[model samples]
Target chain A: MGAWRHFPIFMITVPLLGAVLLPFLGYVREKWVPYASLLPLGTSALLGVLLIGRIPSGGYLSYHMGGWEPPFGIEIRLDYVGLFLMLVVCGITTLALVYSRRYIEKEVSGGRRTAYYVLYLLMSGAMLGFVATGDIFNLFVFMEILALSSYALVAITGNRNAVRAAFKYILMGAPSSIMVLLAIGFLYSVTGTLNMVDLAGRIAESGFTEVLIVSYILLVVGFGVKAALFPLHMWLPDAHSIAPSPISALLSGLLVEVCAFALVRITLSVFTMRASDLVMGTADAVGVAAAAAVLYGGIMAILQKDLKMMIAYSTVSHIGYIFLGLTAFTAEGLTGAMYHMLDHGLAKACLFLCAGNFIYLKGYRRIEDLKGAWGQMPWTCFAFALASLSVIGIPPTAGFISKWYLILGNVEGGKWLYAAVLLAGSILAAVYCLRVIYYMFFQAGKEGAWEEYWHDAPPAMLLPVWVLSLATLFFGVFSFLIIPSLLKAAAYLL
Target chain B: MKKVAALLFISALAVLLLYVVASMPPMGDPDNPTATHVIPRYLERAEEETHTVNVVTGVILNYRGYDTMGEVTVIFCALAAVLAVLGRERRGVIHGFVDRSEVPASVIVKTMVRFMVPFIILFSVYTILHGETSPGGGFQGGAVIGGSMIIFTTIFGLYESSRRIPLKVRAPLEGAAVMGFFLVGSLGLVGGGNFLTYAWPRVAQGLHPSLVVWLTVLVEVGIGLGGAMVLTSILFAMIREEEEIAPAS
Candidate 1:
């Protein structure tokens, strides 16, 4: 009740303060900037871990801003779901910052390094705010913070393609923002308050109105563009691929997942009391789009020659899995979706970091160019292989656990076809991932090039990649650590 | 073909939106749900509770202060983004105008800008300070300050304006302004109020009864300062050409 309640707010402000300080720190001593940037994230991650321990015992914590109760002041709500996602976001950010220490210096110019850290911190802090806030309008504001920072990060590379991709991303992104704002305006008209809990109750009493339906559609489409749902995913691949590797890892690993989390929060919690028929129809639409994404992304990934692009496309497919699980609307499915989000976040980040290491060390981006990469950097190749196994849903890897739950949810929902699609998607994933693995380990090197570049990555970069790879295996084997929280969260939502 | 398809897609979306708009409750209906619930409490008690007469100001700066903090951060971040995209290194000279030394502004225009800038800044400060009781607030006031700075830059040139507020000083000030906002918000926590909570007992202790109003004013000042610094930084980033790159690019 005392300072303990302040942790959620600190989780956001701490990073913000650090980000604002970074430019000056970089000016003072460039060496200190990277390490200084970690202070806020590490603190926030520790806070997240502490909150996780306290939340299960204490129930959800809702701290009102400015000491005014809800429906009057802004609230920071920490439920099992929010805390768990915060842990994921903060944990990944901490690791990415560590990995970026050496990577940013090499990829970004000296003049731009401080701005890179500043934007990185801003993006992560904004994402934390996005997940932790309870007010709907507050969520939109945080969303814009993250979105703007991400666009700039995407273009930070300043290559022709990077700039073009960032521009395209902005064009697509602007409408999504407008749609979300318009939806908020509609909801506000119907209900005077902007609190999520209050809106849910009022929406139920108001029944299924056309305004509500319109808002719901707008929310989905708005968030869908951000989440990179199949039809609206054009901006993701180029933006993800062309970014500096660490930024790529963060974008592919966490940004889209956060959007999906927003989608789940809106559909399940805020619209829980909507007309059953409308819910079913919306679920069907989401399910079909997810199914299409799984197949389409897998096929596109197989066709991709660039390693980063392939991984980015595979993200589209993995996002499909998360959506597929959520739209199933069962407790098992919801839990699966949440678990998959964590699993994919870890595995994809590992993959992107590994890809980045290759690009950094040898400047090789093509899959065929990576022939005999294992001979050069065996540890990195091994990590990539491990992460790919998880990507393909191989057993005893984290991906298998989520896929298992999703398939079970599909079966429980009597959607056998979705179950088949899930299986087929895994096989397709296997095809794309195996191609990279095969070239990395088995394919012949380009004469003596392997031996010339045959050195392990720096400890700073290798450490985070290995930690993430190990986490993928650890979570796959010991799903018990996280599944209970996931179940509790799923139960709360459904 | 692409244009036709785009046209078709947009029209379909527009028609759908129009349909939804038609079904919405009549515009500004007093008996509407928005008017019935939640707002009355705000309208009636906002002044007594938060000690601010302007309900919108009270709601934004006190009741929903967290959102405003996020908004300030967003603007600060946008500036950071602009700096990131455009190199932080100052350009050797401003682009889009003849060298100011070679082509000085006409006496009439220079005198006019010299006459106008101080008043513009003065008015902006007035608006920011009186925001708790008036319609004007940090965002508008900060924009006005930025506009005046722009005027200074345009009339006197980047070199002269930057010399007045050097990049070295401006960069840290921009960051410090946002840091101030974070520090102020954190005061609520220190006082055992929730984050950004202005009316906590501890915060109000030894202060006036209208402490919330004062705190609201303080936050608005922080926001105004931060907004002005961010706008100035963004302008600096945009106008300055990279020293290494040729203007013809």
Candidate 2:
């Protein structure tokens, strides 16, 4: 337990502790706010790297809070799945903070920047906690923290559109959050304990299968809304698109993915352990929903006109791929799904950061407006093209590697329909992403639109964008390095 | 049509929820999983292991302290969220509460609130301090403290109340709960147990034997202070709306 070096608890607390201190730092010295925010974040990221290496290859590191063991105190469990996602969360967050140093100043007004940093720290820390915790109720607590912060982050700009978007997000998010809480209540009532391990055991021993099935449904629907699964995703495009680009990136890249991961954890790690027929039977239905999310999101993305809006829709489509792979439950599918989380996270963050750069520099958010934008900002367009290629599942990009596994998994699971749907979704992704790519590189905007002063976004912005974009390509070519661990994780969950 | 659709959806959810509730083991059934497995430990071992007379306090502050910490952070986050959306309260600007300096409140109302506020605050302090031994704990006491502030603001103008608890005073205090968790957890680490553990080796110097009780009280106070500040700050932030008013003719 102590061997993980207290990385699990400290990693989460450090950021939250930083969040608590931020307002005071701002009050005492306004200039120190961003640096103070970055210190805890960097430490968390560093700890994430250390902890990932320390966890036993196949086992988890679980430490009881207050030294009170299970069925009593909360436990912090850092497994491969949680660790993988935490790194994704911490890594992208670190980059985003670096990116935000400048973007927040420009997008968010002066007085609100400290609040932005505080909320961002809370949001990132909660996301990390959501993945790492082994307790069901604790999961809900972390979810609330992340949910609240993200809602506020969405509306932080306080513009009419941003506020309206956050309102819609809350409208969908709040009730679902309650549904999730209610489902936890249902579990606790039936099972007595809130720890995942204990609940799984109690559920098997208990006679209340009916209650368990209903709780499962509620969790699916609740988490479904949180993840913006196809039917419940009406809130995402507006919320993601209207948020500051970094927030749009964070929401799209990690926040929704964390919800999806929680779904996987609960359904696979807990319910499936019971081998309840009703739950497994319903899971196939969730798979169908995931497939629909894939196609629907793709079509919606293809239909989108605004740059961030299109990427937002693409996230809907990409998240579909992750869920599709997860529901397949084959080793290949799960591996691909897990891998998709990483690749899509990197590619999408890059896409949004690049989008932010375009808006920040050239003031272009529309595809039509992006024409000839490359003439002014070559590097950003290149990063955008690379990321778009990944999104479109072009060969040798991270997206293609994961898409390959997803299709393989679908086929392995004998879900040819889903496999076909996956391929078609990729084509649809190509249609929208390639369209943006073309306008950026080939087509010309209004003659004067190309004329601008600064060549590209400041290095602060471009650095994160390129780092993320390169990671996608790097992971694509070097998929071997990560896929093995993902497969092992998939096997563990299966 | 919209109303009809919403009603249909809600009814469907209601039926599902009702069904789930009905299927759960009867409330307080001696044989229920909660009573059989998780509850007995907390109820039976109230005073010894965790050193709290209140089982609820033991379960929250010691047994499942992490979640309580998260809950407190959630409250802190709510304040952050509000400020992020509405922006922070700045000095020298009148908030959303319109300036009522021209028309003052009645003497009785002001004096009554002024006198009542202190006692209310004092009770809140008592509740917080004795939380681990009593039915009440940090959250309940903190909410009351926050309620006291709201009452004060409603009676005395927002400006006067804001002046009383200025930003500089409450800003650092706002982080008390989280910092308390960190501080206590680190001390537990130093005590060679684990983070948030109450036990320490007996020593001649420093708080050792009652370390657990003291830490619990410490966390309770931190939560009460932080929660009160957060609720107050949120009101201040939301009410701290900014606009320029022209000088009166």
Candidate 3:
């Protein structure tokens, strides 16, 4: 019981220490690299669950770095929102690490495998810190760690397109980082303290409305690009689709979502004042653009040639849903967004892992090539079908529960048009998500190539896929357990 | 039309940025929140609390050392990024990005570099050791050391550089920065203090001042070495490819 006291720092540091150890360990034994990478994330995930269990009823866990008070020292606070984000980060990353074992052998060159795992561990560790930290500048540092690792991971395949995509990522990503830095600068100037709770108390008192509003816009735009919100989403599909699949899973499933979580954290906690109508309009504008992204993503997803690319586009749509709920400014919307972050993370990660299996088993990249894929790899296709239903928000999966809350949230906020967009968007999701499921099970075109590779993915890869895919179903029926907690956390956002 | 749209957007952004700038508190104002609220505590008690002559170092290495730990990880990540993309350097290979001109540096140029390398290294060590008491710290010293590596490579070729700083030597040190944090922070934990706590009350009933000094020294050395190695490797990886890439045809 007392062990949970230092769990927050341990959760972040363990994986970082693993990343530091991986290269040297690679020299000792090549096979040890995969399991070595898994251990830290596995431990981080365990720590995360235990830490969440220890959360005092309605109270948060705070660790002040250097034993300094909140105003002076760096603090790591795991409130309900951060606890939820931490669970998603640690849990999904552990699964991704499990899947990366066999999949990375072919996708990454042998020499770079250690480097790839190192970046993956660093990215996950930074995300754990990013969510759990209570300080703003510390958040920026974690952002860079995560972002730099993501850029490296994207280009890890070392092909021309992968490198090009990663460059585009850095181009957009790096400038956005500077924008984030400027925003942090603006914030530090306005309020001397870098701590989030301290800033929340000081912001309203400072009353420098215009400067605060500008900084808020800067943070939003900066994180908006990272989250891949529309008009800012050009870098996502290529980067997500080109990387090896587990990396794709981590990028689509968690990285963009964490950026959005950072945005939500700053919005709800740091800047609670009604600085201006401009602020409201800005939120509304983000919501509107998210609506556009939903539709844009859905329509484009239907037309994609590549399987993972389609899932990447679907991620854009799901991101739209989260931001839609987020900007609606209703407790229902916020809860829905938080829930969607989990459900979407699980579903999308499952979808990509299944896609990776297809590529692993049959070298299936395009939708057309997946025709009769079920004949060869029944389990992956089955997992795909189950998760895609969630993506379409069917009645019995966790995605439906979150999507329902999203719709309910919009309606509660009187944002009827966005609510309708939510409905239409899912219908579009049905078309795109089901199209692949339909191809694998129904279509039998060009039978020889599809049937040539006639074995399912090995269980190492298949089990994680099934676990994620099934959780969507299990959570869908049982979401009531966590929904109240999510709603409570959302209410505290004010 | 695309260019026009981009220009228009950039202009709008500039205007917005200007508006924010116009609203900011005037720079160096005595009553600015940064001066009145943020600086005084750090400037006033930092030397006594962290025991470093340079207040900035005391603040960076002791109070907010976690951020610097993250920064070193970022540096390490950048190196990983380059290695992952271009691949690591092997002893006997050359890359297209490497200078391929047959003519080597003149004897005097090589001699001068060979002579200056020692001085450069000595100065860097001096900078790193005296970092807590002065303006230069791990990053500055590390940059100088890294510059020496690049210069040595530029004149003496990649092979000589590799021989001097072999993969075995460099591989382990690349993560020294993060490892340094883990070790130092755990020292705090050993005393029942929080992570990254260099010096705190009642830890070990009375933690020694020298222990805190040792923590900063190790962290500074770790960062200095980690940064220098990452930069050196990234440069080497650029010029040297593991499997010769067919010499770019």
Strongest candidate by DockQ:
2
Residue A282 C-alpha lDDT in model 2 = 71
User: Please, what are the lDDT tens digits per residue for candidate 2 over residues B1-249?
Assistant: 999999999999899889878888999789987788888888898577888888889888889889988999999998888788777777565555465432366999888988999899899988999998887877888899999999888777668888889999889999899999889988888777778887764333345437778989999999999989998898777654532233444
Estimate the TM-score of every prediction: 0.96, 0.97, 0.96
Alpha-carbon lDDT, every model:
0.85, 0.87, 0.87
DockQ of 2: 0.86
Cα-based lDDT at residue A299, candidate 2: 91
lDDT of 1 by residue, B138-170 (tens): 888888998998889877877667777766666
A1-494 per-residue lDDT for model 3 (tens digits): 37577888999999988998887777567678998898899999998887765774256888888888888889998888788889888888999888998999878887788899999999999999999999999999999999999999999988999999999999999989999999999888878889988898888786647788889889999999999999899999999999889999999999999999999888877877645575587898999899999999999999999998999999998899999999888889988998899989999999999989988876878998888887888888899999998999998899999999999999999999999999999999999988888888898858377665558888999999999999899989999988888887777664
CAPRI level of candidate 3 = medium
Residues B1-249 of candidate 3: C-alpha lDDT, one tens digit per residue: 999999999999899989888888899898898898767989999887887889988888888989988988889888888878887754344333445422389999999999999999999998888888889988888899999999998888776777788887888898898899889888888767888888745545255667777788898888888888888889888775532554554
Q: Give lDDT tens digits, candidate 2, residues A1-494.
A: 45456877888999999999999988888778987899998999988888766765477888888888887889887788788889999999999989988888888887889999999999999998999999999999999999999999999988999999999999999999999999999898888899998887787666447788888888999999999988889999999998999988899999999999999899876785535566667778888888898898989888888999999989988888998898887989988988899989999999999999988876678888998888889899999999989998897999999999999999998999999999999999989988988888898778798866438889989999999999999999999987888788778778
Question: Which consecutive 10 residues in model 2 chain B have the weakest lDDT in total?
Answer: B240-249
True contact recovery of candidate 3: 0.76
State the interface C-alpha RMSD of candidate 2.
0.7
Task: Look at candidate 2 and tell me the lDDT of residue A117.
Answer: 93
TM-score of chain B of each: 0.88, 0.89, 0.91
Interface RMSD of each: 1.5, 0.7, 1.0
Residue A162 lDDT (model 2): 94
Model 1 lDDT per residue over A351-444, tens place: 9999999988888899899998898899999999999999999989999999999999888888899999999999999999999999988888
